[model samples]
Target: MSTVLRSIRAAYCTQAVVDWLALEIETARPTQFQWLQRTLADHFGDGKRTYIDSIDADASGATTRFLVRLNDDHCRTVDTVRAALAALDQRHTLVGPALVKLLEVSLDFYPKDDQARAYLPLLVARLQTSLEAAGGTSHRLVGPTKRAEHLDSTDTPDPRRTLYINNKLDPLAWRVYYKITDRDQTLPRDQHRARVEFTLQGVGLHQYGINTVDDLAALDFGDFGHLLHFRQFKPLPDLIANMKPELAQLVQHATRRDRNMISLYPFGLHAYRRYNTGKHAGKPRNGGHPELRKHSTHTTADAELNQLVRNRLHDLTQFFTQNWNEK
Candidate 1:
């Protein structure tokens, strides 16, 4: 049998219309509060209007209060996104749920169901920046059968910035986000600038059996290679062979990334060259089927990294088929 090394893109990518979601990201940490605002402004900066609405800090210099306006865009969709390890290669950086939930809140703009509402909870820098160190970052999902705030911007809702799932299958396996700060929005465009402080993340790695500070210290991530794909593909086979139920969800994700590294590249360059070069094989032909097969539907033309966000939005309608309550 001839082998066709296809990109297992679809297997990992999810596409279903979920209509309603109410999320809230609550954090007690002062630095994280500012970090959240900074991240929102940085990611949605290009086409959207982001404003640092307000700030309140205590006398001891704790940034206790914060609000940033992340303008809504109705024409965006995060299709086939690959969540990166938003840690940006920093060991001290705090990652995991808090950052992810805060992100979901800022990027989620559900413009379709203006009448629908849900209360719920939700990056990294351009490349190596980390979100502020945080404690007690959590989220609340409200209203599949209930509603709150009734925060609806329009009857025809807009597309949201980001969408990772809330299910038993994926969990933290899907944490893709972007990075940086855009503070001082009140100044003129040319005068707009803020000092971006690079700090060591106070968070520790809790994945695998490594959770405590000692555990993290014992294992040298120094040998973990800088390539994000290295840890993904390398640890996968072992995770699968071990057949640990606890790791099943993670295994499914790793399997997909393992497939995407090879398959997705074709989606990007294959079609472009086919039309221009008139050659099915972009550069070289393999010892498989002599001719390449055309896809029935050209589903994915997007090649941006999983972390690249185009349009982040939030809406009232629960347009989805699956979520915690729905399931």
Candidate 2:
């Protein structure tokens, strides 16, 4: 597997000098935001909006936030981020270092094998089930409503496409989704792969000790790696391998269809319940059905998937640290 820090949205809080200059720009030419955005974009890269693609200023002109997309191979470095900030500084002319605020980080994974492809959907389903199991009153699901006073322009998130773990307004919120489809030709045919993405946002970045670009540059795999998990659904043989002799015999004598059904757990249990009570034999007993359930279970994905994430995270960290020690 391979991983990349696909994007980040950070804000540069202007100091007093730039604040006055920004306010002056806003006053003299209320539409300078767009022009400034273009200037900064041009200064940072090819001026084609490929690197520092998004730029904007707040009402007070005290802060400017930009979205940086590390889309190209040459731009995947901490130096790129620093260069982005430097571009902003050169254009804004600040007296001191800009107060950097990280709003979100998107980590994208490209699976090399079929393990992640097979497991990702199941993993998402499990996460959704776990969230639903938490019930409605859970704070993880609830947040302030957006109304007349609290109107904010945000995309209506599609639950089917993205598995959001918590309310977006929470201190820390994240989501996972597959970014590529069969029709997507953004990359080469062999590289046309399952792009599983995990996004982290809000002040949770601070809680995770990611305060600055440098912190992100030095992030450890364990810092945010624990968020990804998988559940392995064992095969039929493994599911029933430990049953007692009589139980195993009862399971063994069952038809291949029934054995296959048993592998699915509770679904198969229903059929066995009827058989154990002699319902099929027209001699059903009152509450005589033996209790049966799936006992064998695994919490972790296969080793291949686990190591894939670890290796990819290492690669991502290496990208940030490659030019890190030089300057």
RMSD of 2: 14.1
Candidate 1 residues lying further than 4 Å off, grouped into runs, are 1-23, 26-29, 32-35, 47-57, 60-71, 74-327
Error of 1 at 13 (Å): 27
Please write out the lDDT profile of model 2 over residues 169-205, one tens digit for every residue: 5554444444444223455533422223333444655
> Over all chains combined, what TM-score does candidate 1 have?
0.18
lDDT of each: 0.24, 0.39
**For model 1, the run of ten residues with the poorest summed lDDT:** 119-128
RMSD of each: 22.2, 14.1
lDDT computed for candidate 2: 0.39
- Candidate 2 residues lying further than 4 Å off, grouped into runs, are 1-32, 47-75, 95-164, 170-178, 181-191, 242-298, 323-327
